[model samples]
Target: MDLEVRHLRVVCAIADAGSITKAAAGLGLSQPSLTAQLRRIERYLGGPLFVRSRQGASPTALGEFVLAKARTVLPSIDAIQVESALRAGAAPDRRPLRYVATPGPLMVGLLEELRELFPGASPALRTETHVPTAVDLIASGQQDLAAVVEYLRPVPVPPPPDVVARTVATEPAFVLLPAGHPFATRPAVGLAEFADAEWVLPPNQACGLFEAFTAACVDAGFTATIRHEAESSAARELVARGTAVGLGQATFRSTPGIVPLPLAGCPLLIRQVLLWHRDGPLAAHAREITEGAERAYAAAVRRSPHYLAWLAERPPPGAEQGWAGAGDAPP
Candidate 1:
C-alpha cells in the first residue's frame, strides 16, 4: 500500500512516544488497532520497523531510516496544509471565523480585535471553562480557533496533533484580596503568607488556575483552604467583601473593594496560547489574534492601577519581565 502523511505521522508518534500504547493514546487510536497497523506497515516495507521488548518498542536500523524520512516529510506536508488553509480562509466563499476561549480579560480583548479584523465577517465567540475542550473543538473542525491558558508545571502537556499553538502572552499570577485586608497594603505577598487565609477558588474543572493555585500553595508548604467555589465574577465579589481571597490574572482590574497584588517570588505563571488546526481556514488569522490579545492585555494592565504597583515592586531575579511594562502585559 502507498504511504501517506497520516501513516508517517503514526510512525513518528510511535518513535517519539517509544511505545505503541503511548503512541496510540497520543494518536487517539486503540492499541490493538495501532499494533495491527504497525504490522501492516512493516509488511508493506518488507521489514520490521520496531524492536519490541518488555520495556517498549525501539526503532530498528530500517525503522530509524524510515522514521527520519517521515519526520522530514510530515513537516513539509504541514506547511502545505497551512498555506492551503490560509488561501481557503481568504477565499470569497470563506465562512465566518468561529473562535472559542476561556472567559477572561485576554479573551475579552481578543474578541474585540477579531471583530475589528474581520468587520465583514461576524466571528462567533464562545466561552469554554476548560482549555483542552477548546483545543479539541478546534482540532475537530467544530471551531476555527481557541485561546487557551496553560499553567506551567514540572511537566507540561503537549497539544494535539495537527493543531498549532502560538504563545501570545506569559505573565505572573496575582493574589486578589479585600481592600481592607492587611496583605492588600503589602507590596507583594507570598503564597505561604496566605496559608491560613480562606480562598475563593473556582471549581477544579473551571480552568487550570485552580490547579496552579493549589500546586503553588503546596510548594509554599501550605494547603489552600478553599472556602467558596467561585470564579471570575463570584471570586471578585468574594474577595471584595473580605469573605475570601483568590488568585487573579496580572491584568486584572482593581475593583472598589479589592486589591490585586503580585506574588513575592512569582512562582505561578500562566501562559496564554492561541491554538488552531493547521489544516483549518482560521490558521491564517492566528497571528492577528495573538497580536490583538497582546495589545489587549497591555491595555488592561495600563487600566489596572494595582497591576502597575505590583509591577513597580522589585520582582525576584529571573522573574518574568515580559509583563513589566504596559507594552508587555500578560493575562
Candidate 2:
C-alpha cells in the first residue's frame, strides 16, 4: 500500500499520546489494530519508528525525522481542507469577510475598502489589544486576516510557522503634549525635553514595548515620572489637562487641547503587518488589503504636518526597502 498522510498521522499520534493504547483510543481503533497499522507504516519507511516499553512510546532517530515532516505537512493539509469546504459552499453574495486587528486607522479604512470590494458579503470585526490573541485567531482559521503590529522592543515576535505576516507599513512613535507646552512649538523634541514632566504612559502591552519607551528616556538623560497608564482617549484627556504627557502613534489625532509632536530622531518604531493563514481561503486577497492599509496610512500622514515633515526629511528605512508601519496605542 502507498504511504499517505493518514499513515503519517498514526506515527504522530502515538508519539503525542505516548502509547499505542492511548493513540488507539483517540483514533477509535482497538489496541491490536493500531499496532498492526503501525507495523505496516514502519515497514513502509524501512525502520522501527518508536521504542516501546512500560514508560510508553518514544520516537527513535528515524521516527524523529519522520515526525518532524508530518508536523509541518498536517497543518497544510488541514488548511487546504478548510479552504476547500468554504469555497465549495460560499456564494458571492453570502461569503463573509472576517477581520480582526489590534487597533489603528488602517482598520477603519480597510473595512470600508473590503465592503466596496465585496459588496454583498457580510463582515465581522474584532479588536484584540493582546497581539497573540489576534495571531491565534488567524492561525486557527477563525479570522481571515489581521492587522497586527510588532513593537520594536528588544523582544522580537517571530512569524508563526503556519501564518504569514506581510509587512503593510512602518510608523514611528510620537510624543503627545498639551497644546501650550513650550516643546510643542519646536519642529521635533528630544526625549530629554520631557525629563522633568509627569507622564501618562501607554498601557503595558503583552509585547512589553513600554520598557523600550523607558529605556529611550534613560538614554536621553532622565527617568520618566509616570503618573498613570491609559489608552488614547484617556491619555489625550490626561495630556490635555496638563497632568501628564504620553506616547502616541502617528495616526493618533490632535484634539483642541492636545497635540502630537514628532520625536527628534524617531527612536521608537513599529512595523505593521497583515497576517493570514497559509493556503486559507482569504489568502488570495492579502495584496488587496495591504493596498487599502497603505491608502489609510497615507491619509493620516497628510493630516499630521509634523509626521509628514519628518518623513520628508528622512523617510523610514522600511519604506524605501519594502514597507513602513505603527505603535500599539489606540489610533
Candidate 3:
C-alpha cells in the first residue's frame, strides 16, 4: 500500500516518544489530527498498531513488524531526497564527522594527524573524562565514534547490538606516583608492592578500566583504596603529586612532577578498544580521519616499543591476549 512521508514520520515519532501527545508535539501536529491519521493508517492495514496503557503506548507485534520495514524504507526515501537535491545543485556539503575521545597526549597527536588528512573538513571532537558517557554518546548516534578503555580481562557492558567495537591498541599500564616515591626508582613494580597505596581512578561508569585497576590490585592480593575517583588525566595528575597511585598505559603523557614506573611482574594489562556504530556508515571524510588516526597510532607505537614487550606477557585468567601491548591504559 502507498503511504505518505507524514504517516511514517508519525509512526516513527510515536515509537520514539511512546506517547501520542508527545509524538504530536514533536511533529507539530494537533493531538486530534495525530489520532485521526493513526486510525486511518490502522484501518488501511486492517489492524491495530499500538497498545495503549497507563504507562504510555508501545508498538503492538504488528507495529514492531511494520517498524522493521519502515526502517529500511525510510533510509531509501531520505537518500532519494538527498539525491534529488544534489541533482538540483542545491544540496549542502556533507556534515563534519563527530567523535568523542578521552583526551591524552596520544589523542592530541591523533587529532593532529586527522586534521592534516582532512584539511578542508571540519571535524568536531568532545573530551569525555568518563568512558560510559562517551559510549552512551556514540551508541545514541550523537557521536559518530568513541574511544573507550578495555581491559585484558573482558567485562560486560550494555550496548545496542549494532554498536561495533574493536581493540585498536593494547599497551601496558604504568603506576604513576610522585617523583620521590619509593617505587619511582624501580624499573618495574607489581601491584603487590603498592597494596596499601591510595589510587585516583576513572569513574566506575567507565567500567572495564576501573575494574581492571581494582582487580589488578586484588590479584596482587589486596584491595585498592580509592582516595579520589577521576578521569585518566586527573588521576595521573594526582599520582604525580604522590597523593595517589594509578594504572596507566605507556600511552600516558608525562605530567609535570609525576614519575611513571612500570607495573612490574603483574600480568600485562592492555587497553581494550575502538568502537563505532555499524548502523551509520562512515562517510569518506570520516573514514579519512579514521585513517589518519591509524597512521598516528602506528607512529606512536613505533616510537614506544614497550607496548610490544608488554604484549608478550602471559594473559591473566579469563583474559584474551589477542591485542597485545605494554600498559593497560586509554588510547
Q: Evaluated with lDDT, which candidate comes out highest? A: 2
* Cα RMSDs, all models: 8.9, 8.6, 7.1
Query: Each candidate: what lDDT?
Result: 0.73, 0.73, 0.63
Model 3: lDDT equals 0.63
lDDT of 3 by residue, 1-331 (tens): 5677767767777887898989889778898999999999988877888998877779999898877777656544543443344334443253454557875433556667645654443446777767767776655455666666555554545445545565555556777788888777766777787777887877665546656666676778888788897866677668776788776666555467776666766554665355565554333134454566666666765554444444456542232453333222223
Query: Residue 215's C-alpha lDDT in candidate 3?
Result: 62
TM-score: which is higher, 1 or 2? 2
Better of 2 and 3 by lDDT: 2
Choose 1 or 3, whichever is better by lDDT: 1
lDDT of 2 by residue, 223-259 (tens): 8899898876788899998888888777776588887
What range of 10 consecutive residues in model 1 has the weakest lDDT sum?
A: 321-330
Q: Tell me the deviation in Å of residue 48 in model 3.
A: 17
lDDT of 1 by residue, 169-282 (tens): 677888888989987788887789888999887766534566667678889999878899875788888889999988777777667898888888887887777777766655
Candidate 3, residue 160: the lDDT equals 53
Best candidate, TM-score-wise?
2
Judged by lDDT relative to the true structure, which candidate is superior, 1 or 2?
Answer: 2
Per-residue lDDT value at 197 in model 2:
87
lDDT computed for candidate 1? 0.73
